[model samples]
Target: MKNSTLGPPDSEAHELQRNLSNRHIQLIAIGGAIGTGLFMGSGKTISLAGPSIIFVYMIIGFMLFFVMRAMGELLLSNLKYKSFIDFSADLLGPWAGFFTGWTYWFCWIVTGIADVIAISAYSQFWFPDIPQWLPALSCVGLLLSLNLLTVKMFGELEFWFAMIKIVAICALVCTGLYMVVAAYQSPAGDVASLANLWNDGGMFPHGAMGFFAGFQIAIFAFAGIELVGTTAAETKNPERNLPRAINSIPLRIIVFYVFALIAIMAVTPWRDVVANKSPFVELFVLAGLPAAAGIINFVVLTSAASSANSGVFSTSRMLYGLAVDGDAPGKFKALSSRAVPSNGLIFSCVCLSAGALVIYLVPNMLDAFTLITTVSAILFMCVWSMILLSYLAYRKQREHLHRASKYRMPGGIFMSWACLVFFVAMLALLALEEDTRKALVFVPVWFVILGLAYRSMRQKKSEGVQLSYDAD
Candidate 1:
């Protein structure tokens, strides 16, 4: 509503509108970063690192904090830069933009499917007799409809989506504190203690293997952390709001992750949780609540739906930016009557529709989920690596720009090198994990494909320039 724009130049003169406020940006970052993965897949994280999983998340959080700072500083450099890829290009090169933009787009598409699939699975909690395909289809139709209304509507929806997560997490932390430090013993078991986190099998219960193992899975939970940066163009006060989102989002994620994982492990012990099931849900059951499964089931289902909602919003926004930049199909560049990039929103929803087919068509559910996560992580790694590389290039090639920056990165290239190394190490860690190895395979293949695509686009541009010169 507040940030709508007029029609695409190619379309009937129109406007594009989006009603995202600074409040919305903060919550979107909160909601997007704290995904269903932490709620559902955290069980696996607990199983891997045991209690040490908490430490793993903190470590990754620190690395990504620096990543966000780099992104924020880059975004602040130019108010007109709508797309992160634009900044990537300005900072690094056209190749960086080409790779980062497309890869980031690809990552969300994969992540969106996972969210949709998870949404359908969550729906099964309340409707055991209903077919999975129906709910998945219904969800796709529903979110698509909501996004089409207006940009403000999208922001409003995200606000609620984020509110749900924030509320649930706060409640969980309060309840867990009552149970742990308050020493309130539930009917089902012994009282909890902070000691449970360290004393049960010790802090490093799973040993170095488990400690390393947690990194492979934990990184994926942090996938949407950059959503705040993506919204710089849309925000009314990028200088103020974007920095606020970047500063607070990481700390919130770390708290949510470390506390929630600690609570789950304290109640059930890492060994007691089902490898395939959600540990968040199990914490309620362990607390001896009669409605544990249903309550948590509802919460996680909402979590998945919330994730889908965000994936659609961000992907469409990215497409809208690329379209405006001549990086994507021009039609997708068109604005809505409401000033939102309605065309790109529709395009992303069409892709999301494929989730319905997957509801019933997969060969195996876990296998399909694993493939999706692997690809998402690989693509995300590529996008993140580009950001770091772009920052590195920016510092060296644009010394004047760096000195001119009001929000220059501290230690400058020093932090840039650390972040890049961290990104590469994450890719390597993905390769080492049996659970995440396919990600390694998919990522390089993606780079090669992007390379070819970039080359083709360059050649076309060269021809276009030559033809224009001849005409002149």
Candidate 2:
């Protein structure tokens, strides 16, 4: 068996530096837990499922926490493995790595496009006449330049971006609590109170079907939750920092996702939440804050920037891993002097720039955003399932390692199967909605393309081997 501690043959020449400290990892994990979906997508979730959206976020978070644990344990099991792709390749097969790596790359590209579109829309809040492509392309260019610097620069960018999100959510929760305490009434004459959660139509106001519908959008909110796993190669002290970051996911979700939604619902009631608007903005606006729109717009704008930044960072890293394993083009494996994968970053940013075109090409922005996000969510679930499957393989093949590991997954194989089942169920739920169902149907085409590419890649490799033998 290949040594788990060993990297690629040329790792000495080009390796990702371990520059991300515990603080960077922690903030990155926090940023991943609190995604742009919460800021921009929760309004629709609330409208569809009412207060039950809170439970949807919680359930998704709960399941994903186990996925993170599985990932953390597997990553810690083999320090040489940069991301889930490495382990999936090692434990499952080359094809597993190929599919997971490229799918994850595509997943973030799709998501980054959504964020790009969102950033443009948010920019329009301030500059109503500005072309959507202007802000969209500008964002891609800015992130590319920043990411091209160093891994630490990416860390700092995410750190500050995450800090902004943290502050916004905390402020929203605190302000909403104060409003509830003082019996603050909105302009619509709705009293802010905890009872507001169920007072209008009860906690599961939309019934079981509405609650089920929430999972589709709510799952997208956690798209980047496992983003910390991608930082294993760059993070300092994997054993300590990786576990620390993973363990805190549950708390972060409760505070950032559940509490923030609760505050929004309490402030405006779910029924009053404008489906197309941000409930975060609606909460403050309904509370009579004159600058609420601009404030939340800036926050959500930064929130989208943060998600796009993460997408850029993770996609490059995954590409670096895939290239090292010979799944992607070898060019992506070359790291800059600062150990940043410049080639992969450029490729990802260029793909993200396509979002600018999406704005012009797709006449209906809402439908486009929905399709993009749903596809992203589906692809993310596939990646998450791959991680769990990798964990299961680790437990079986590396039973001794599992027995000796200091950080074992909470429920071990049992939880792994449970998480897999949960993801399968979520996929079924996707079929119930027309928008998500369309994305669901569209996703199989990606797999089909990957299948063809993998076959061609293998055929070329076999022919190259045969040619070398003939020369010998």
Candidate 3:
């Protein structure tokens, strides 16, 4: 396979290596599918939407699956393209690449900050006396050291992290199923049964508005679903592995998200779930298993670390790509002996430390988390929308390529438009909540900054070209 075009021109020494194997790719995709948002944020989602939160996850997963398929087709169409940023630039314009690349980088950075805050909060579960920022900064330091070692190291870390999450979810589902069969009764005198889903107040107990409110946080839970697209440059056999990973998204969502959520609501009933606490932990505690609650807390702690690790890996690679494309500083183009972008990694970690500052400022963890995640969700939607837009552009300009391709996006241009509309609807949903609406107002400032930066970049390039012309 050709080296990724995002790599430095004319230098094999600087190219990102294709070292991630099939297992790594599969696990990474799985890790991305299950994010910290599900473990930590689902309680709020349940409280807001009642049992209808299940439908929220399903709808988001369904729409995002199409986004992944579109991305997979585009990345596979040109072997040299590394990530969505590359193709967006090619199929759309330089502005699209700049905006997508930086926005995506910013998306992860914002997400990493959220993860840091989550780690701090989870650490408090085990060590209540420890200062919050202590664990947050320590988590960032550990991930940076491990990531600096090799790309495979990152894969191995994610692989194990995902395994923990999978095992926890599986155990939760099994436990819930057992409870349902035995007609297990919780301490609150509520019986665990499938009927619990609607027996109390019906599925849409919160009505349409509550159902709509669920979208705000549920959308955040799926933030990293497109992450596999970022690993395109490093994945082995992109033609084989990429398609396998993308195709399995539906099943993963059903098993991990839908089934796991069903288990939570069935065990405790939606009405009794704590809005500010983890439903996974609460489910275990409701079943009178305090030990399992503690273990689930540890599981969530690792889940937060997993997400931060992913954010670190992706952000660095994105900066490297932007640098190679002349949209970022030249130093970020440098790679370590391991072919990892050390400069980008360090820079991202530094940005991640800002999470500690946020914690100090907001004081209220839930409010801070809600605001940060909403911002992340909004930026991630922008990146996802760009992928759809790029797909639409590809179908229009490269009809021959589409016809010749083996893995064409299902529903093609039509689904692309549909997904775009869904994202717009999600933005409207974000406006319904006070915290999320505050986030919506903050997001425009970021775009305005990017707009000004892009214009400055263009003017400099034009001036340089003019200088060369005058000398000639």
Q: All models: lDDT?
A: 0.75, 0.89, 0.92
Q: Estimate each model's TM-score.
A: 0.92, 0.98, 0.98
Each candidate's number of clashing pairs is: 17, 0, 0
The prediction achieving the highest lDDT against the true structure is 3
Candidate 3 per-residue C-alpha lDDT over 49-155 given as tens digits, one digit per residue, 9 for 90 to 100: 99999999999999999999999999999988989889999899889999999999999999999999999988997899988899999999999999999999999
Which residue pairs does candidate 2 place in steric collision? none
lDDT string, candidate 2, 67-131, tens digits = 99999889998888888988998899889999999999999999999999899888999898988
- Residue ranges of candidate 3 with Cα displaced over 4 Å: 1-8
**Candidate 2: worst-modelled 10 consecutive residues by lDDT:** 1-10
Residue 321 miss distance in model 1 (angstroms): 2.1
Candidate 3 TM-score, true structure as reference: 0.98
Candidate with more favorable, higher lDDT: 2 or 3 = 3
lDDT score for residue 366 of model 2: 74
Q: If candidate 3 were superposed on the true structure by all CA atoms, what would the RMSD be? A: 1.8
Q: What TM-score does structure 2 among the candidates reach?
A: 0.98
Q: List where candidate 1 sits over 4 angstroms from the true fold.
A: 1-18, 182-190, 359-363
Pairs with backbone N, CA or C atoms under 3 Å apart (clashes), candidate 3: none
